[model samples]
Target: MDDALVVGGTRFIGRHLVAELLAHEYDVTLFNRGNHDNPFAEDGRVDHVEGDRTDDDALEAAARTVDPDAVFDCVAYHPADVRAATRVFEDCEAYVYVSSGAAYGREDIPKREDETPLASCTAEQATNDSRDSYGNRKAEGDRVVFAAADDGVNAMAVRPPIVYGPHDYTERFAFWVDRVRRFDRIVVPGDGTNVWHRVYVEDVASALRVVAERGEPGEAYNVGDRRIVTLERMIERLADTLETDVEVVYAGSRELAAGGIELEDYPLYRDHPHIVSTAKLAELGWESTPLSTAIDRTVAEHLESGRDGRGQGPCRDDENRVLAALDYADR
Candidate 1:
């Protein structure tokens, strides 16, 4: 059996990729901290090993034991982490790094895999309070993995944008879905004209699988859907889906920043506004599901899981006030 090892297998995208790999008949071994309960216990094909990606000794031991054909890294944040993991998996057939579209500099030019210049921080020491440091660190991480590709090991990078779906702990999408359902006045940022690119979690996983099987070694692929939606239209769609009459107001990024309203700091990267083209993935024969369907599924799943109070009691009026406040600030 062809074996693969996945780091961060319990995450939103990682979990879906694990399922997809199992469906494709690849004997998969999961390497994670095992902090959460096993979500795939019913699937006997998955083997679990507890370890940290940054710990070279643990990774080397796991690599020697699993002897995987490929290593899919879903949690590499720093270049050092990638370097540490690659040192251990040098003999693997392929090493897949889950990168982000934000690695591309916010230049005026349209970004492609090969055209955009990667950015990195050069500080001698690391500080946790810096925003500029994070993306640069991720860019450096990408370089580390790309350099690790050699005669015995192949490396590929997959960059995705704003992934959302069931089991999504990011809660960014849920924040919006919950607000829209309450029939409150919505607030949009910066004229509500910024184009946002999004990809469903399942689609992202499928694209990752496709790239793993066919992506060019030492190459990066953009795995976003072609369609870009504005924040205003997204709110409208949500209101329509929920059959709620909600008013929308406009606000400036500067105003929100001044008011200490930090909607932009959300973990899901929902604050960034940019148009990303996925023509390359399309050329690779990957098809994305409709955006409406994705939204409906996510909202339905959030409701069904009883996570957002589907059956506790009559939906509280206090919920409406909280949603309205977010809506006001988001605008």
Candidate 2:
């Protein structure tokens, strides 16, 4: 495909994916709400269609306007969103649905693309803070594209675990990075050994591109670093990257009960082992960034980017109060 339409491309993973698409010599057109500033706004090489994803008419118009060879659905959450996409890009040759590993749900074992049992999704669930609902919806979205195969939409779902890198809006990794940078002590909100597997934001973009360009339709691929890092090791890697021996404190669920702190507080804080097997996607010739290397790069990029206006952990007061209570208990 010579032309690719990115459903959204002005932020973290989407931004990096746009860069990758451009580097690969594909003409790019972006469809977004135009709320965020895109660095490529003035570049002639890119085209833009401004509208909300939920605005089905706008989406259909953009898809018809671009008439791309491939469409990358970056922000589809609900199955209705997927249905909206099918109606919009009816003529597009290839479809890449950027689903999440969350769709795989909390299986007792590590997830492989083909084996893990998936949950169900709904409109209300997709928009809420519930992980199960989000995953269920993402999974359902994947099914939407797969089921649309009879209509000739060549689609594949790219499921990702925690995606961390520069320009992340979620501040999942930023919580730890920023806390470590600003304070002598950091409170990790879990038992500190919860299993985690994260893919770099750029790595995710690259993987998505690979799927768009070469993936088998109706199939889903799991992509991430093979190395599993615990939430504790994750923080330590930030310290290691910054060359600071920050004091570490572990405040599991009980301690954080008062602060409305959930595992989501730390991006890598998984409810269970979310380690992903990249073997399926690896066969397509894409690779995930190394854990330590990716961490160091993220910390460096976050630091170089002024680290301002990014996310931080819970308010200092809340963290401090928890830390103080723990310290008193220790004494």
Candidate 3:
């Protein structure tokens, strides 16, 4: 698409998507509430449309002003938002909604686009603005895309597992980056094989563009790292990226209890592995960033931003207690 509209372009994935669009030489416009600082405010290449996606009138105004060939809905948290945007931008060449892998109702080794069941959203859950209902809401949003596409709207969805990379406000991966950078030895809960699939922000940005350009209407594609890494290996990757050596200690749930820690306390730790098949997205000529390259960019940005991913994981004091317990048990 020669012209693109990115809703909520100032934050993590949206921010990266704008850069990706600009790099590809597409005229870009951002639609957001203007709360977050616009990274492109100084750049003369991008345009901004100040409006709330929640307000139907404001969104309509933006669609008219931009008359974009492609529309990327980054702030669509609820199904209703997707419904409204599809109706407003039905004439666009493509309307892409950013969905999440969490939308998969069941935990599977590798969740696929069409085979895996999507989480069912109750009407109440769809409207509730809570993390507990996030997956359900996102699933409903995907459903909205399907319905819109059925009505001739060129709408598609891309579901990414956990997105990580530079400008990640969630700071989930940054938590581990900080530990690897500052500590010689760090404790990883469980046997350290927990796999929570994560896509780099830049790759996710590219996936959005690919979906918009080449995806079929009514289709939802899963986006993630082509090669998945375990929790332990992820830390190792981070350490390698930082050019540092680290001792990755594995702790069992029972041992972690010595420090009042649970496996859930770890940001990226999961009891069951979570992986999504990206072969579907790749079929459209999309490729993920290499692990080492992704980690290098993430670590470089983490060091520059000084984001320790604080509040995203258990406290260091508690982690130390767990380490002590593990050491005592070893002895």
Each candidate structure's count of clashing pairs: 2, 0, 0
Clashing pairs in 2: none
Model 3 spans > 4 angstroms off: none
**Candidate 1 per-residue lDDT over residues 165-266, each given as its tens digit:** 887876767766776786466555556665657788888888877777777777788887656677777778777778788877655555444444444532
Q: Give the number of the best model, judged by TM-score.
A: 3
Local accuracy of candidate 3 as per-residue lDDT tens digits, 1-331: 7999999999899999999999999999999999999999999999999999999999999999999999999999999999999999999999999999999998877888889999999999999999899999999999999999999999999999999999999999989998899899999988888889989999999999999989999999999999898999999888888889999888888888878988898899888889999989999999989989999998999999978996899898998898887787789
List the candidate numbers ranked by TM-score, top first: 3, 2, 1
- List model 2 lDDT by residue over 77-134, tens digit each: 7888898787677667788889898887557466888887677766677566564577
User: How far out, in Å, is residue 188 in model 3?
Assistant: 0.4
Q: Pick the candidate with the highest lDDT.
A: 3
Once model 3 is optimally superposed onto the true structure by TM-score, how far is the C-alpha of residue 107 displaced, in angstroms?
Answer: 1.9
Q: What is the lDDT of residue 51 in candidate 1?
A: 86
lDDT of 2: 0.81
The TM-score that candidate 3 achieves is 0.98
TM-score of each: 0.84, 0.89, 0.98
RMSD of 3: 0.9
